[model samples]
Target: MTRAQHPAGDPGEVARAFEEMPAVLWAFAGPQHRVVAANRAARASVGDREGIVGRPIREVVPEMAGQQIFEMIDEVYATGHPVSHADRRVLVDRDGDGHLEEDFYTYTFLPTRGPDGAVTGMVVHIVETTRWVRQRQAVEARADDSERRYREARDVVLGLQRSLLPAGVPLLPRLRIAARYVVAGADAAAGGDWFDSVVLPDDRVALLVGDVVGHGAEAAGVMGQLRAVALQALVSGAGVLDSLRRLDTLAGCLPAAVGATVCLVVVDPRTGDLEYASRAHPAPLLLGPGGSARFLDGAPTGPLGADGKPARRHHDRLGPGELVVLYSDGLIERPGQALSAGQAELARVATAVLSEPVAPGSTLPALTADRLGALLVERFAWAGYRDDVTVLVAERQPEPPEPPALRLPAIPASLAAVRVAMRAWLGALGVPALPAQAVQHTLGEAAANAVEHAYRAGDPGEFTVAAGLDERGVLRLTVTDRGRWRPAPDDPQDRGRGLMLMRALADRVEVAAGELGTAVTIEHRLQRPAQVSAGAAPPEPAAEAREVPFRIEAGADGPRVLRVSGPVDLATAGELERAVRAAGRGGLLPVTLDLAGVTLLSSGGVRLLHRLDAGADPAGLRLRAPRGGAVHQVLALTGLEHLVT
Candidate 1:
């Protein structure tokens, strides 16, 4: 029933019933703006019990008196119609702490007409809306299924992320196309990093590697926006520099540059020549035949969206048989070191990896991907640099078996014979002209890594090196062995420059190691090296999050749990916002993670517990071992955990 104007008759009882009404009600002098009466809700809303009568509305809500909020009220009062507002946040005007809440209300400040049709006072009604908002959010969540939401979201996210990549590889007559992008984070969920392979309108291929800067939705959002802007700019005719300048201007509004880096390369594909710019992207790994890898010097440009300076471009070229691999910094940059350290680590792996795929046309992508991916996982998995990684490989395709053969010896054991063999082979190809000695050194490294790592002593692995002319007529040399072998860890004390030294002799390096053993490959093209600036593009840091390391003290029973904001996948698990003290090495007590903030948890997330348990680090602390609430309940039914918190 309405709080005001009740049925007449039981006058005393009716008055009692009216006084107990729940809604806050008020009577005011329409023109004077003085309060005439208030029900319990209204009085309490203003922090009063019994003495709040006869005051102006301004006196009760002092803050509002100065704020422009009441301008609408004045406008309404001047007009003779009732007005209402819903779901509006208003500040309660009590002393001490000011609290804000959503409220709905209807009002009539027009002159109140009495029985004589005269003006006296206006009336107002108030209703709380906090519960309504909560209910709406709950309804939205219930309507969404996690699986469908994730699939739809991935399509959207990847589509947006793909724009940051080059449109496609340019058709250089000498080059064969092969490139791939691998997500660094665990399966099912990925981060803001991306790669690009564009066939520029100029016919020069423009390759880009960049990171939008963060892992979750916000990072994803910015990544999508930036990529869209880049494609629009480049595809429309904006030069690389103009695109960089415009991107920086827009970046000022970002939360922080925790997610921006773009390295772009424009190569004159027809001539096997190139010009490039890198913001913070990793230098491309140039692989050649004969098992050699080298980190080429590209003018490291600053990142995109960094300072407001236009980025400059650098230049270079590809010989037939040489390959260039561009990748996101996430491939090398980790939590505890500088870029050089990361670069060094990459070089070590590059040299060791250039083997086995022997066939550049079909098997190279898979072979290159495996070694590179393993390196990243081994180095960063638990090191906590939890960011996404992307790698792209580009190289000249080797020729079909129609090239003329050089006068060479049958597979021989002597180093001199190998040099004589290499010199004769390249001499016949008439490209990638290198000294006999250089060829021998590269060939020796390939043979040594294979003999030492791929073969099980005297087992005589079935691999052997071969030479040929690529379609562009560049020299390609490969060392193949028939036994399975992983990349050998370069011993620092040993003089083995490994692939790094071999890289200097050739333009591209490749290695394929699997059950088929290891193949060390290198390409030495006679194509002249074009001079290009190896400068970094300007810096485009991703939007970094503000992180304050805070510790929560727990009650004897542990703190009340709170859910996290994102899902927990194989890449991330058990960090349930709970902490436990460790007593000894491997001695840990199961701790409950409130999980109030957690939104998604995968089966692999459940499996992480087993991995963590098997390798329990006593000295290193891992928090929230056992997930709880719904997760705990689910695990309970499955008997996965008898007492997992």
Candidate 2:
């Protein structure tokens, strides 16, 4: 086409337009690839404009020598074709400095044909894209960092939740317990859900489940504090309402604990009586032995730190072989579902799982409770829970067997037999060695009173020792003799020392005199460890005889330390007094009596110590006993704690 036909399409017009355009444009000629024309953008990109036109492309941009741009332009010119690249990295010394700077660009190389239709030269168009590329990279880096921080926070919250939960449930004679905890979905922050069980001093079992508001570390921390406070109150024999009241007051102090929810239930394993209180928590579910399930939602209260109204206590009973379940709201909450529907689904799933016949030889409620809890968690949380899920199951077993009874004559010799028999009985009942020793010492004192005071001389009266472990787990021992009950003497030196010892050791002690005889009954509650299973067989007693030869080794040196070993009781009290007298050497030097090896320190030994202290100087006699040992505990209980060194 001629320039006269379309003035705008003239070569000069096109060249002028290219010179003023913002894009980099250049025209190359011949095989040497000389620069035929250069635009303003082109000169600016090279950071120099002097002597650029009519120069070879290599002379104008010397930094591009090793780059593939020369070859690409040559290929386009020879083949009469076009080539394009996007975001290509290029290094250039734009400021004429020896150092090279990196940048990104998109460029196209187009061939220009001559009149004979042969490729004559190439036209190149280039655009810089460095700013856009860097922006995109910065955004991606920020996203990656945010994701890493979120994962770390979730891990910390999860760790806190697990650490705050109960390590293991208590094992009681007539009760079985098990618990399970499940975290939220993989991408979600951890929610606070926890469960706990404790055996109260009155032999009642307390079950607790709680959920703190919100998610992450704050929620977990609040849940931990609430759990600790609730446990302390309940284990200390606080009533259900009283414990919840304490938690309510505590919630007022903790900002994060506001609106937290908890359900506390105390059950009497012996009678299947349950007393529970709620703080905006879900009701407990009772699973009957006949596969029937029901929710104990009769009583409900507002959340903690809400209205000042006192929480109401609810009462229920668990039948034999029936199990009660306490759980966090997460166990029954489902997305896009009503609360009632979720609860019904939970009841259905639990009943279905528990309806199946129990495995043979798994009659122990512990195994059954464990299986139930695991199955419940599996059924409800298998699809990835949105909140933390927790479930606790407890079932009452059959009544335990009665403890054995013992009968012995009212004499000093019967003291040793009483100790041996009581030791065997208490050990069989899964009682710890320390408590067992305490019980033996208390019963020995009761029996010794019968031998020394209950019957007249030459009366030949007999005393019967009857022992039983009541449903409350209190060890009860009754010593009866067909004799008179002696009253305490007015003189401090001649007072009823054995009676004082019995009262100090046992939880409750009673002495009664009637037409038939005088009876001394002692009661002490047992605190068994979690490792001891319900109705575990009594461990076999060691074959070694109980009679450790009573001996006193008086060191003939400074401080006069006397090492005493063996059973110190009514039969050996005289020997002990005589040995101390002989070792005292006129009571001039201080004497330390080490009772670490004394297996049994009865009231007779305590009375002897009192007499020795009363007659000698205040600092003349010192008693040495191992800390926390049976003998040490005896001395502490008998009001002789100050005498122990």
Top-TM-score structure, candidate number: 2
Per-residue lDDT tens digits of candidate 1, residues 459-536? Answer: 544446676653333456777766676444543333334465567556788877767656677865433211110111
lDDT of 2 by residue, 1-645 (tens): 678567668778877888899888888887777898888988888887488888889777765643445656666776777888776655566666554555667888888878998888888899988888567645533344347467546566454555777656654557767667767654456576777888788878899988899987778778888999998998788899999999999999998888888999889998999999998998889998777999996667899988767889889999888999998888778667688877777777777556544333221222566667765665454334677777888888766545556677777888877777766655444455566777877888888888877776777877888888755566789988888855535345655667777787789999888988888899887653221111111121222235567788865554378888988988999988877876777676668898977988987888788788888889989998877667887788767778887
Candidate 2, superposed: residue stretches over 4 Å from native: 1-173, 176-206, 211-401, 486-492, 526-560, 585-590, 615-619, 627-630, 633-639
As a whole number from 0 to 100, the lDDT of residue 496 in candidate 1 is 38
Quantify all predictions' global Cα lDDT against the true fold: 0.50, 0.74
Error of 2 at 632 (Å): 3.7
Best by lDDT: 2
